[model samples]
Target: MHDQNFTSLPDLHGVPVFYPHGTQLIWISSNGEITRPSRETLAAEFALGVVLLCHRRWSAARAAIDIDHYLDVMELFAFVRPARFVLPTPSGLAQQLGLARPQQGEDMAALLPQIAFILLDELASTPDPARTEAGRIATMMTAGGWKWGPYILAHLGLPQPLAGPPDSRYAAIWDRLADYTDYTPQAEPGTQPILPDAARQRLAEMLGENAELRLPQADYAAAVAASFDRPDAGPNPAMVLAEAGTGTGKTLGYLAPATLWAEKNGETVWISTYTRTLQHQIANELTRLYPEAEAHESKVVIRKGRENYLCLLNLEEALAQMPGRPRQAAALGLMVRWAGATRDGDLTGASFPAWLMDLFGRSQTNGPCRPARRMYSCSLPAL
Candidate 1:
């Protein structure tokens, strides 16, 4: 994950600019002297990632983050950073700098803060001078904190601008704020307060007969009128090696218990199967069973590598370069159709041919189905 370009630059201002996964640093001085940190010192500081050189240095390091964490960090870095245009070096930038960019599976530094306070502050309190109020509000909503923002705005009596034609929703509010040219919010539907346990009772009634209707389940359901009654029982962390033959309900046995465990602990459960067929089957079965098991509700999401998803950039490039190519046209057509249907961008369906799957795997930076990043090797859980 260390970059060669990072090896070329002398550290500027006693600060070695490093990305989350990038480790190499070049030292620069006021006297124009460039010196590499000693290998011994680097080893002491960063065992695998440390390197020493005359003018540039490259180092290797080990990380303990898992693939999920790595992806989350990437997301945080990309859209959640407080400072606009502070994005990390993109793949294209790395290429321009002649540095080897870390692979998609690389770990993200754990210590880096990922949340942006500007978005939060604007959503909760006031607008930022740098960002448009609309942009700040939209970003906060997309980042999943809109609920609180709207509620707070309502309580504060701040007027949000109505958008679009004057004949539209904000016609009245616009009349009031038109002179000021400030945005005004259209009135949102008022909510009526329900009985405290109404939702829980409804959920319980919905899951009435399901065996998974334990306290946690009942508490979640609206029909079952009850207080917290379930004891703390969850899966113990362990490395399990099992070899079960056909006719064994291995799929159900694992899925059922693991789904309940996930619900109880509020943790994600990752399931990996050896064969593509098994992957599809397990995902489909889990999806089906989730609705039936009302108390222990779970959502099943199948995630594959990015290549499996329609690569808009690559597709655009292909189309622009080969407008008349029959193969390209056909590929584009198929991608369009698949984009509408595929869930989680997994291009594995009965209609999708095996050859196409192979082609996608080869042509795209499609990562492994399961996150097999080195940092996650030790953290993978057993079914």
Candidate 2:
């Protein structure tokens, strides 16, 4: 996580940049001269990230920041310094640079920063007014009392915008910026019948071009049909246990009938699965079965576990307690990026490291985190 997100990274005790994971820097002069530091060390990398995103304040404190997206800083930093480099890897620098992972013992960490220096030096602009920001930013680094003050003060300078408009998001900072929703829970179970045969026929028709009904799937569909046909349509719903193995097309087997039944009866069926991933998978299939018009009306919706979301309240508390906690720092970096990008707040398909899970588990709750009080309250209503 790298793109300039953490002016929030606690300005620790007059030390402008103190990163946990390894980070290194390459100092470039206004005249485009390059100075190589010890690329083997983490000391320069984190500081480099700080200087890259440092907002000039004619004073020590940075300009007031507006955090609009979930870890915009992480994206920024990643763009400059991919975490895959600093973090230990068997492939090392070669892999991080998209080169073939070599078997030789060349120190990748040592080499990467130097290579990075070469690239930046080549790209560095001529010493001129456009680079005034870079010079001012390099000055800010020296003003922070870094051990490498003389080097940064001499070499680095230029406040060029790292990204164009495509990479930036304004901090409109919506609190309850959720979908406009108005729904009422049904008071009783819907016992009315939807034509199972009609739904079954529809499924067959839709898949007719490429798919044919398998014997096991057809049998499963027939059993579903029998359950609905039961004479004893009482308040106590009938239970149907099914057994099918892989390649059985069981999803379609049950979906064909269930779609018909729900359509016929105008009822919502709660489909449960062992994992949230599977839950979304089923929801996607339901969408394919139904048209967009009906799908939006609760015909298919994913009801995830409480943990699968970004909690702003928890995030604030965590940031407050972030000093001296490196794992939380790393996890927060990932969370910040996730917050900005994910649409439904679903953690599905996201890669969560152990630290992130530890952090998320601390904030997760079965119900609303708290009774609705403020915008950042525990409850995040799904739309």
**Model 2, span 278-307: residue lDDT tens:** 766676666666658555534565666545
Say which candidate scores most in lDDT: 2
Number of the top-ranking candidate, with TM-score as the measure:
2
Q: In model 2, where do residues sit more than 4 Å from their true spots?
A: 1-74, 77-172, 179-190, 226-232, 290-299, 319-337, 348-368, 373-383
Give each model's whole-structure lDDT.
Answer: 0.33, 0.41
Q: Candidate 2, TM-score vs. the true structure?
A: 0.48
Estimate the TM-score of every prediction. Answer: 0.30, 0.48
Please give the lDDT score at residue 146 for candidate 1: 22
Error of 1 at 331 (Å): 4.1
> Measured by C-alpha RMSD in angstroms, how accurate is candidate 2?
12.4
lDDT of 2: 0.41
